[model samples]
Target: MADQYAHSGEDKRPTETPAIRWEEPPEGPVLVLLDQTRLPAEEMELVCTDASALVEAIRSLAVRGAPLLGIAGAYGVALAAVRGFDVDEAAAALAGARPTAVNLAVGVRRALGAYRAALAEGGDGRRAAEAALAAARALHREDAEASARMAGHGLALLDELLPAGGHRVLTHCNTGALVSGGEGTAFAVALAAHRAGRLRRLWVDETRPLLQGARLTAYEAARSGMAYTLLTDNAAGSLFAAGEVDAVLIGADRIAADGSVANKVGSYPLAVLARYHHVPFIVVAPVTTVDPDTPDGASIEVEQRAGHEVTEITAPQASVAGAGGGIAVAPLGTQAYNPAFDVTPPELVTAIVTEEGVVSPVTSEALAELCARARRTTAR
Candidate 1:
């Protein structure tokens, strides 16, 4: 994909295409999302008029990422309210659609709260729906602001940690404009560095069993004109050994109170590598990604996906689809371990950069204080 770049002075700062948007059609309100599953090959939008369709999109990863999931969940609730579905039931289903990302539930409850509040004040169903839509819009705008703030904080931290300037950053999974209301978590930080001329190369880890880095992150990098190279997940160790990596940046699905990060499956290994190589391993996410109710990594639920995702290989070069749209790579009846995400212990992480601030040493106290400060600020 990088080879296809037309270096003719094109603006490479990631197109301002939204991953999700709330639309009010003549028929009713609908949630429109870019179909992420068809990425790097096709730019398709999934227009969902009901909660069930939105749930399917979430489960199938058509709309993903922690921050984006929150935004989508809020919009899902608003869609239900406007369409006259039972708001509580719709919120429940949307929240449960993907349990690993706490942001989904958080976003759902926020909009649901607004709807209930408006209804309690004697508003009609339509008025309540309007309140829900307003809440969803607020969450959406907040997420975009959080993304921008996180990018600023993360880039400053990178400069502080690696003062020599040009940085070779290694990233796992996808975190860019496609994943958030604004430029995404870790990738947004990298993008900031690139824009500042401080980024040398971005080593994208081809996250196995999913290839999110190869298919999504690489696509975003190519469009942004970032100097990037794609490599197998295992090859990161070689890069670390050769001192080719200055830092490892990644986004989290859920961050526990103890500052343990639950991110894509390969993130833990990269954290271990970064620790071994004495490189800065930073987690960039909004404060909403932190779950204070979850005490530690052991308490975070790791989602287990279907074995077929691991047992089969799906590539654009494939001639034909197998039984379930992917050509089988493993022998028939073979079992595979396919955990959707892995938890990285706080000790392995050098810092957690959020829109609120940076949590260095990543202690429980630091995380709590950051969240507390953010709450107070928001209250004001």
Candidate 2:
């Protein structure tokens, strides 16, 4: 069977590292980015100077995918305060731009509260901005480190489950260096395994509405020189049915207190199939993404996307699926409910991998204990 991500390996090796950084200007406050929309084709960074630019970046999907969005949101708040905007209003605006990802709100609130405290003691705008920027930069570093930790835990789980010489994994969307400060969540582990000589192949799902897996994951895989193959979302069922899939690892947008996961829209279906196939379904995310505040999966808000996303399709290279089907698939005026994400109950999940460690059973106690251990590791 041809591996899914092989389609992206046309490039012999990856040339650049995927990361978003803070720039310390001589006169102005720290300058950060609003990543450009065109990637793999063109890697551009937006030099942000205001809150509105950051808001537009988040809204336009210029800087998206959950983990990256949260980090960008944190930097946005820091940027706003540095540019002399009201910290409270800046944080609010950043938090409001996206409702689904708990990480975004958490990152904003984390910076906001810290900035507010400094100002309460008569800190100047400069001092406040620096404080917020420091927090934001800290998060950037933390996210990178978290990615590595997730890779370790995910790999350990793989080693435990598969006693084979090489590991084959299937994943949805794009969880790579571009999605985090480090290599990434799910893809990070795959890349780590590849480097460790344990990875046999990677399957990148052509995530619909946007082909993040095809366009982004494939791009990342090509650079890394990893063997990969791309397949349509529907084709995943065929892979699972054929027993070609070893395990499914994906990044999470949000994790409820009870361990129910909210990830890309198609992830829930994959979980259902994983159970049928006796495959492990793993969710990799940072501790920051876990929301104890949202009691369960039902409480986590889902973002409804535009009908156009489902109706129209765009990609760097059009699939050889023939012509005329080239245009939007849905007829005009057709109502489409495109929720950006869907929740998968803990029962469907085999394990949730955090930077701290892999937690099975996914009970509240297990989840809490895992998180506390992660914090302790970081503290030490």
Candidate 3:
């Protein structure tokens, strides 16, 4: 609990804000999050005093990104324990808030395990709660460390794959300091390239139904002083056709045993375009995102969000009267197919970059070995 919002290494950009932090106020401990929905327009903090509030924040995506979800889930359990709530119930609610991200359940289990283990060892409720908080803090620290390692590995892979110094990278959705304890997954790699003067231009896709890339990724890029341009999601094909893209980098919500990646909804299409264009389609994530229990891509359960997310435009400031949260863009009662994420098969992925290393020619055996290596390192 020493540095609740500590990021690893020197501060490269002083203007960046942390997406999540744990704070102890006079009344009780709370999980404070920078409300992402209001990003690029206004900065607001949402303080969650209980697990239920945190659950809503997760469902609403006030705090998101797979790695950050795991960290927030662990802290949610700690908040419940420290507040004298039923730890088991809190863990279940937090883990179940979002189904697609494996990291959420994993984080909840880790904190709950520590709490239970302490209680079983004849420790009182106070001691057990302390153990839970400590577990959450440890996880936060580990994720920051993982983020830094991932950036290093991912940047190296970029350099090796595209020996040309100046790299033009295209990215879908949002992955940055706003999404991780450190810089972030795919975005972190691009940032590393920018720092090394190898980044020529960052082409951002305005991911539809949400526009995370336009709002969030673009915000981070500008804050970091990186040269970037925003484009509609559909325009990616034109960029690929013109050969303006050197590579495509994306972050994963969940990685199945066979190396299939479940990222934001538009990620799979980018992978396909990258494949057709003969560009490297790289996935950058921590080892924790990989789930050995999911046998293949088809087996991975993708979360289906409400249709209104597609039929209507919702923003923190755009509260015009409409069927959904914002102004309605489609006809009244119009149905929409809105899956929060899409799966990209391993065959299309050029490489998978994790804190441990990079895996080219992605296969189940290689992915499993990477996960095993991470587990062994953690155990030691």
Candidate 4:
């Protein structure tokens, strides 16, 4: 059994795996990620002692997910300052690692803002580091709460849309305990439904290039004792064709002002499939995933990945160097185009569930009203 931790032992989370880490870090500004590459097997932390190392972790996906990346980036700045590296250089390096990730930029800018303010006040590096860590922790706490609220709102929407007793939801990539500060974004909602006796079975897409769903998400489902089955990315269409899915719930990397969501590669295709199958396609993410400044999907830059992810499939549990334990699924020397994420148009998106509530379609007026209502609720 995966080691269990205690929260309030709250009814909100009624699973063997409690909410992941509700306490603050013992050491300030250190990046500790549950090494995701190893799942359904070993749970390990990739602890970083410095900024550059943290950057490598993000680049290598030792740590990932937009919200998690934001938290890690903030800590990276703090780590840089703590280790005597120039804060500006740290911000530059961290922000430059992933160009398309809005969270990375948000985290870097937040830390940079704190560092500048502290410098202006003639504070030492220690105090500045403390401030940076404080920002990251605040983000972390807020994200956890957002996860809960989003799950509630999303589950409600699911109940209304499907109105069926048992729901089989299709999701791509890993968006669960390993992806966020807590339960997760999309999977959190599905897990919520499971707790409420609504979830039938979860369809885990073996996300290609990384297999996050096959490896990480499935591990979480198994631990939580949720009925889950994993299949290759290509098999999702078959499931939808057979009417196995009632809805599609996935987390977003970024949502433009026009509500064009960017998620893991192959998400756009699922959106198309859902539309054809008359399934309710929904996106569940925190308010942090939205970028009001970015106008549309056309403006969101899609990141191209390395050829290796396409050329070979490594055993998720293999530790040996050059382990062919995973087969070479793709042809050798064939140039491959791998975009880290694909943009889903608003027209295809059925609704967007945030911590506040569900937003209908994608429109400036509707989203603004939804956001305003959310702010009012938060204020209370």
Candidate 5:
């Protein structure tokens, strides 16, 4: 069993407990992740001694979210290199651990590239390992900065789209401090609005199959003292019908060249409803999430998960483990098609907000330009 740690103090900030962190102890370097699977109930830390352990955590959704996954991937590479393991193998495994999130692969490649470059420059294993660690730290720092910038851009867009002061934002999944190096993607924007005293309410969707919003987002919101309400995933349409939602904010796992967004499953329905309700449906993500290689929504590979995740209720507090795990919520021999994510085409998106800027009327050309601008800025 992974070791558990309770919050040190009550006065700590809502986001004080970092979702992912790295520590160098006497033994060696270990990547420490705040076990997300046990969150909102128990505060636990999963210490990963190697890339394999980290890979398992990633697969288990113990430390997830698009931006955070990228950070973890980079750190996993650094861990392997620093520990004198096969850097190439570790990078390949981390990158392929989870598909759909382009950031994870991007981060792994960056760290591996740095390590190889150091070797090419006649550096020894230790030096190359240091280079990889530096790359990972740089990516982590950059992601935090990107999160802050995205919040500003997203909040500004929110203000412009809904000039009315008191904004009521609806969000899906668990985009918050748990998801990024900084506050988060869509949830960060809502946090900014709340901090600015312009937010009236935040409606959180209970993301099914895992209930990330109900368990994670609600925990963060409550800690932050934000006015929020949690509703079942299917209850979102009723909220939209009642004109309770002013805008819909969501974070993306991957964004294709044509501005297609692949987010947590059930996001597509929200987009469709947002369009029908004439509400602004915005996607907030960092530029790193945009994948020019994935040409369109059709090309974005959605990961299919085990059917047991749907048929069983895996709560951290559940005492008796059923056949599949937790309590069996479905009958035996029931089969389920559980896709981890769903794609939302560009046409349904009102705007794509990134640290670089917002892309209203999302287009392939505009997304490419945004990615280009971000690269140029990074080069500088």
Candidate 6:
């Protein structure tokens, strides 16, 4: 199974591909995405000529990851404005595509606001559209810079927590260049450790139901020439018991004001295990992921996916009828409870790493201060 999903024994970094980009065709501007659903086996691009197409792409997981979703959302609005579509309608649809990631809504609103401001200042339709595009580009650039700074701060935190040189880190889901404009959140720190020769091994969780870890993280690890091993999500306990894991790192989808983090479904379990073992479980994300309006974990909404994703498995090599596609793994009418994300309370989290800095012993007061500082900086 690992052989099927990863290119093991490869020691060279793979060529980087921009996960999302704006393309100008003679017809009009479109949003282009590297289809993540068809990854590891096929490299394909999905072109979105309108807001509806982009919405379907988000829903289908053709383009994913929290940071990348924001970039795609802002660009979607820009595409709409440049193509003479209803700007307000486009912003509403794009922002609604995914509710779990606050960055998506934030990006859409920033671009929409820029467009509205320019129009109110006596700018024509074309000038307003240009303002929206400029806003989207600015957001894109800022995300890339944030990724870099987050990597630096996270690595520093790792060094402080673990005085010893060689580190064995465990991570969940997919956080790499495929997920953000720069390297990534948690994964970027790991990459930095590898470059500094401080990394011993990267234990990857084969995030189930979607296998984002197996198909995506492993792919990235191999490409970057990192010493990594793919394991079933349940196998992590054995590693902790054996004293093989030194820390746990993961990226967040949404972080509430109280510092609770919502991430991939399997992440909360890892956090629990890390806490029990006295290992540092770090949550890494950009400041944009923090939602001050969300008072606590209970207030955040988790997106539930379709039952088919859990009930069926896709194997391209099976010979049985329909087995090569989405073969059924359960009863036809069986109901599967599939929540796309799970929240980890701040108490379980050892620290939260953002582009600004690290918040250890995560508390409501500490998180609130960080958010306030970020707002003050942004206002300038």
TM-score of each: 0.95, 0.90, 0.96, 0.88, 0.98, 0.94
lDDT of each: 0.89, 0.79, 0.89, 0.78, 0.91, 0.87
Q: Per-residue lDDT for 41-113 in model 3, tens only?
A: 7777788889998999999888999999999999999999999999899999999999999999999999999
Maximum-TM-score candidate:
5
In terms of lDDT, the best-performing candidate is: 5
Q: Tens-digit lDDT track for model 1 on 46-77? A: 78888998898888888899999999999889
Q: Clashes in each model (backbone N, CA, C under 3 Å)?
A: 0, 7, 0, 0, 0, 0
| Candidate 4 wrongly placed segments (more than 4 Å) | 1-29, 317-327, 369-380
Name model 2 segments beyond 4 Å from true. 1-17, 25-36, 316-327, 375-380
lDDT for 23 in candidate 4 is 30
Model 6 lDDT-worst window of ten: 1-10
Q: List the residue pairs that clash in candidate 1.
A: none
Q: After superposition, how far is residue 62 of candidate 1 from its true place, in Å?
A: 0.8
RMSD of each: 4.2, 5.9, 3.7, 4.8, 1.3, 4.1
**Deviation from truth (RMSD, Å), model 1:** 4.2
Judge candidate 6 against the unseen true structure and give its global Cα lDDT, from 0 to 1.
0.87
Tens digits of lDDT, candidate 2, 1-380: 00011123233343243445667677565444424345556555565667777777777676776777777778878888877777678778889888988888878877787787788889977787778878887888888888888998888889889888488799998888777877889999899888888888898898887777877888888788888899999899999998889999999989988999999889999999999999999998988888888899999899997777777665434552313233567776777788988999999999988887788978888988877876787688
User: What clash count does candidate 3 reach?
Assistant: 0
Distance from true location, Cα of 188 in model 2, Å: 0.6
> Against the correct fold, how does model 5 do in TM-score?
0.98
Model 5 lDDT, full chain set:
0.91
Candidates 1 and 2, the one with greater lDDT:
1
